[model samples]
Target: MKKEDEAKSRRSFLKKAGLGGLSLASFTGASAHIGDQIAYASQNVNRNSSPSDLKITDLRIAEIGGDVVFRTPIVRIYTNQGIVGHGDVRDGAAKEYALFLKSRLLGENPCNVERLFGIIKQFGHHGRQGGGVSGVEMALWDLAGKAYNVPVYQMLGGKYRDKVRVYCDTTVSKDPVEYANRMQARVDQGYTALKMDIGINLIKDIPGALINGHEADYNPYQHQSTKYNMTKHPFTRIQITEKGVDKLMEYLDVMRSKIGYDIPMGTDHWGHIGVNEAIKLARASERYNLAYMEDVIPWQYTDQWREITESSTTPTQTGEDIYRLEGGFEELIKTRAVDIVHPDPNTAGGILETKRIGDFASKHGIGFMHHHAAGPVSFLGCVHSAAATENFMWLEHHAVDKKDWENLVTGFDGPIVKDGYVTVPEKPGIGVELNEEVVKKYLVKGEKLFAPTPEWDKIRAWDRLWS
Candidate 1:
């Protein structure tokens, strides 16, 4: 066949195989000679992804604030084919986690996702520390998906569901009636399931509610950094009196009166109380039929989690702070510590890893729920992973009230969440692009948008796990 005819046939075959029109721009940028063959940018698509030739040219990150979580570190991985993929560090996590891997990833093909993830997985640890390696993994999947012109979910063995059911986590409220009304409002707004903070503060002002009290000067609302908040559940020795359980039940009571048992509700932020208090709260919440009692104690306390799950009728959950499946989830799932395994995709090693966790959990008859409270990038990455996860119950939608949150990324039609679920996107990569103008306005203080990081481009330490 003639050269033109041959090119046409190849394009036709690729299109038929669901891998055409990648439109990746090559012969420009950093791509000199990638793989065995050469490809070029086309007029119709303009940008293209040459799968075999795709190389990670650069990785840049920006910390975005306002409307989203406190501050979510977003990463953009640029490839040789002019295809840029987006990922996000867990909200409140340092961008350094992802940027620190730049030297290891530079010049490697983005399509070698599993191989590359193994290289960087060593850098990830549990909690916010895992955000960096997880973010890099997200961007790599996005890059690989784009390179093949398929959605991220499709790359993850396709999706099991068309849309993912979302559970919105509402703000904390002190007043019993007011908190109930807030939860009701979410139900009215089409959220089928809801999660709210049922913490000590709700009953703190009530007399005889708490014992071994929080310090007066410390504001428990912005209490994350406080010495009081820093103490682990068991060490705090904090106790919630019967009155405290009564006051908390009042919140659940009032909530049930407003929204009733029809709406699936989950309670979280049950405060710094220990095993006995956690059991009390869980037992008190049983009559209300809460979806689960989340983070009853630190996830490291597998025995505590098993205790809570066994003691109460209500479901038990944890693992948002856990990293890879091998990190803590293996023990949690195998031992059946919690009824539901909650993982934030950005904090749990991104899409594939999170999906793997869910898949593993499903075999043992445990359900996985995504704990998402980040920007759209991380949220959508969770959405993709959740869609692919067969037994995932419901994914958390923390920004239900943030009107501008969905505007941060373009690619989805209408609201990202509608009627308590997010439609699985069919677009390539993570399926969204940052609305740069809107994103620039939300830049965290002193943080630039996708800034250069030549300093991080150097390998600082020997990363070998074995000599």
Candidate 2:
């Protein structure tokens, strides 16, 4: 054909294909590519998914309290594409905390996780209050991963391990021998790491174990009032006497003898004692080579954490209640105040933020350990984070003895907790679906299962933190 005829045909095709406004300059140097562009436009298109549009359609919750003490609220985020993501509010947190986020998430793309998180993060606070936003963040990641056909860990820059190391909390006993036996049982069950509650209450009945008991009638083993729960570490005015330290030492000796030094054993629930006593107790237990003395003082006392970490041979860990990395864990990690950062994903800003926390701690030469007590939904979230984090030591499995714990969810290739490690799921999203039958069997009284939440569909206030 003549050059003029070819040019006329190209112009005719461009106009017919809805590219009529293309300037000659736009394709002036690409005349040779006109045939290729026309060929591309000839292909059939699946308009329904041509651009892969996905949107959050609804959010619901199921509050289930099994044989455990905690009533866990599991949140499900449903998308228009029929893919649903699961997340769990921190145990003991209200379902409304997560439902309240429906107004902020409706019609948003779950793939824009960081953008959505920024919009909703202000609603979260430290501890259980963080559960709502964190849970929603977790669900968003799950949805995003499913939409992209990748595991949650893969969404967090791939994973470091196929199986996550889990540490189970051993049942505590007042009798030292029984306590040792119980720890051995955990070891027998395939747990290589263990944690025990070593507190003054264990030896409080022993004469001269604790000093200054007359003032507050403090009881550490059982919950009393806000007086014991809310008091800062320094203001507790409670001290473990030399005899008390010896008693704790005896318990540790029994545990060490039973579990052996090869296994990493941690201690927690040391009561509301001040820093000095915490230091003393930590020093006293150094011989046992505990994994770390957790929450030696409160997590908020950065200086005190540094003091205990510097003064004792045992590594110190905190941050289970810390909400976000920037304001809550940055100072602690930057200052090296704690030897290990123990974040509960349910409270530490969900999966990605918790991974960020682990990455930050890794930079400071600190170890990362996860603290978890909820059901398998959040537990799997931690599993993915632990699999991705290089500095992760172990994840706490709070439901070691709960027979029905593994039944709450399905989709695992094998046992949820085998021996001691949890195999990270290769499936998309969180990799498990809630067992509705089992969940309903354990639902908290008066709580509905995935009930409609219309009240949270509209915003009612000015939520912007900045003017």
Candidate 3:
């Protein structure tokens, strides 16, 4: 009779509850079952999780640049959401920095850029090696930005400009007419600012004399001189003669004449000459009224930069090698060593960090220009930063001559440059996607494309420092 009564109770409960329904008290007793199902679903969600979820993904070297520069080996960080961010290690940095620092980043949320930056920075100091941390940090922000469906500039705060102006390196030309023609061609293409490489080394190989009666300066880096007496610039024996200065002045005049007076041109690669000589040459070139003289003295010479900026009407620009904004650029900014702060994104940490550097410069009333002699990854990174910065003067496009340069990256939905300006990508992350076809075509000899990095699996004892 009892068994029959219980069976009748179950039937009634099922009929009332519909799908596996029970009375209120019975439903309370089944709560554990529902909790078990919920827990099981949660586990399934985590099953496909990635390192980016934990915030740590190992980095591996992918060599991209070779005969073709856009093929730069950039670092990519994988995340749990299947989202990845690509970052460029500094141009020509040892691959070890990226490899070693990968261990330090394991299990951290890459979105926590400041936290990861502070932790991993203990592994890096400055110079080219900082490329590892800088690159990885860039990739993290890229990932974070994508995960949030925002641009990197938007992540920093907000953008000050929709499009960023770019400066291109002037093509080297031996013939005055050829150089002038090139300058005009750049103008025709709508480049607002251009930089010329003015070094006597290329002209040295010319028969008889490169510059009329002036003896070409024999730099040890370029020529082997038994008596390498390095005096300074004006008094220095390299190109001090009136003839040498005349040759340079003639080159400048040709550029100025061909481009007319509207262009903002700058000169660089003066070679290994002292500050005093550089100052005299700068003074001599006053007729062109250049926008700025770049690297007049090695960036290390703060006092010399101050002297150059003070003595010349032209604004002096330096700081491509500077590492951090506070320590590296503090002296230069505080003292007004250079009128502009030119930072290479690869060398200057990542986007947010570079923005910090730019903001600091603004406080000191200095202008900013980004230095990018790297591939698309670094260049795009600079684009995001320049868009966010307020005091920007111009960003550089080193490979403006190559039509294929912009094609190497897959993320640009539209034209990168339009009417002399580079428009910031509106898409999430950097708005660049890697062109696998281009990578295959330009891969360095035997390099593999996006291979698995299993070597970084186990953390070595040396990986942990504090514990």
Candidate 4:
């Protein structure tokens, strides 16, 4: 009588619950019961948020000091559904770039990431100007991932690797051995690839090593506003003498001797040397077997880049400052101008666009590399992007020397880069939250951490682009 009653109740519940097609007779005492069926049916369901009904309510920012990771501003996109997404404006870019976009994003569904990206992408440009669009794009991906309960890379069409390899972007030193020692420390810390700046400044004071370089007075990294900083490579007429080439060789020789040639070593900060001079240095670099000579000339110089690449055995690379595909990296990849293309996701169009850039480069027989010099918020986004890129070589880690770098974000298991790689995050969204305590300590002078910005709440323009 008791078994009959239980069986009848199970059939009744299944009929009403719309699972009547399943059978009670197929069940055993330990499994296949109606209760078990109910539990299994709901295993994939999440009551987190109504993702489709989700809407953006606000956008806020927290500006951190340069030492915390290139002084990049972090943005938070709030939604009516009680979830928030985090992102980082490109290094050195003003916070206004992202704040200004708030008016345009208000009341929109952040889950429609690509669509919203297209809506505001017009306001973005090359270099740091693209920070606003790129940062917001990252936030949207985060929000969408949370709503869908999937990893950001999973939302970006899945991943190609379980972990993303990182290369140490070693701190610059005028002394080659000092720089090499810092990089050796990274190798000891388990880095498999390395990069260092070996610029004209190293040989600047050496008489007869350079010609027409007297006016080149400022360090491009420290002083971008100066005349020398604004001038292009070709315009500077900064020619390196055969002696200068030898002087550069000495640095490479010491580096190779100290760190060895087993791991890939790339070079950057060539300073504004022209196409011919870059080609000369490229030829000189052939003997050291450099992994690449980064930004030998500016990215816009496609013709000049091709000239340099074709003229030397040293691999050439550029495009860390490019924003989008069509007008940004298309010409370089199509023309086979560089052996590899690198793009910082924060400045290069965020996650998906960078993925597209890599896919496009791979189609052209070019390898893809990641460039990152910002805080961990954007660094994690770059990790997801790199994991999704099939041809990815190495993701640049500018904070390898910053001991507290990983502490800037909370809820992560271990150091971001362990044994020279960042494990692809399995958690939803970009995978971690900003550690508020650490962030407050490093906030830019007047900026609060993720402060509310009601001042940018109103859209002021008739923003339609065309008829």
Worst 10 residues of 4 by lDDT: 215-224
Compare candidates 2 and 4 on TM-score and give the better one.
4
Model 4 misses residue 68 by how many Å?
1.6
- Global CA lDDT computed for model 2: 0.86
Per-residue alpha-carbon lDDT of candidate 1 for residues 328-408, written as tens digits (9 for 90 to 100): 799999999999999988889989999999999999999889998788887888989999989988998878778789889
Cα lDDT tens digits, model 4, 406-431, are 88998789878899999999988999
lDDT of each: 0.84, 0.86, 0.74, 0.87
Which lDDT tens digits does candidate 3 get at residues 341-394? 898888788788889889999999998999887678678888999999898879
Q: Candidate 2, clashing residue pairs?
A: none
- CA RMSD of each candidate after superposition: 6.7, 6.9, 8.2, 4.3
lDDT by residue for model 2 (318-404), tens: 989999998999999999999999999999889999999999999989999999999898899899989999888899999887888
What TM-score against the true fold does each predicted structure earn?
A: 0.88, 0.87, 0.81, 0.91
- Residue 240 of model 1 has an lDDT of 87
How should the candidates be ordered by lDDT, best one leading? 4, 2, 1, 3
- Which 10 successive residues of model 1 have the least lDDT summed? 27-36
lDDT of 2 at 419: 82
Cα lDDT, model 2, residue 384: 92
| RMSD in angstroms between candidate 1 and the native structure over all alpha carbons | 6.7
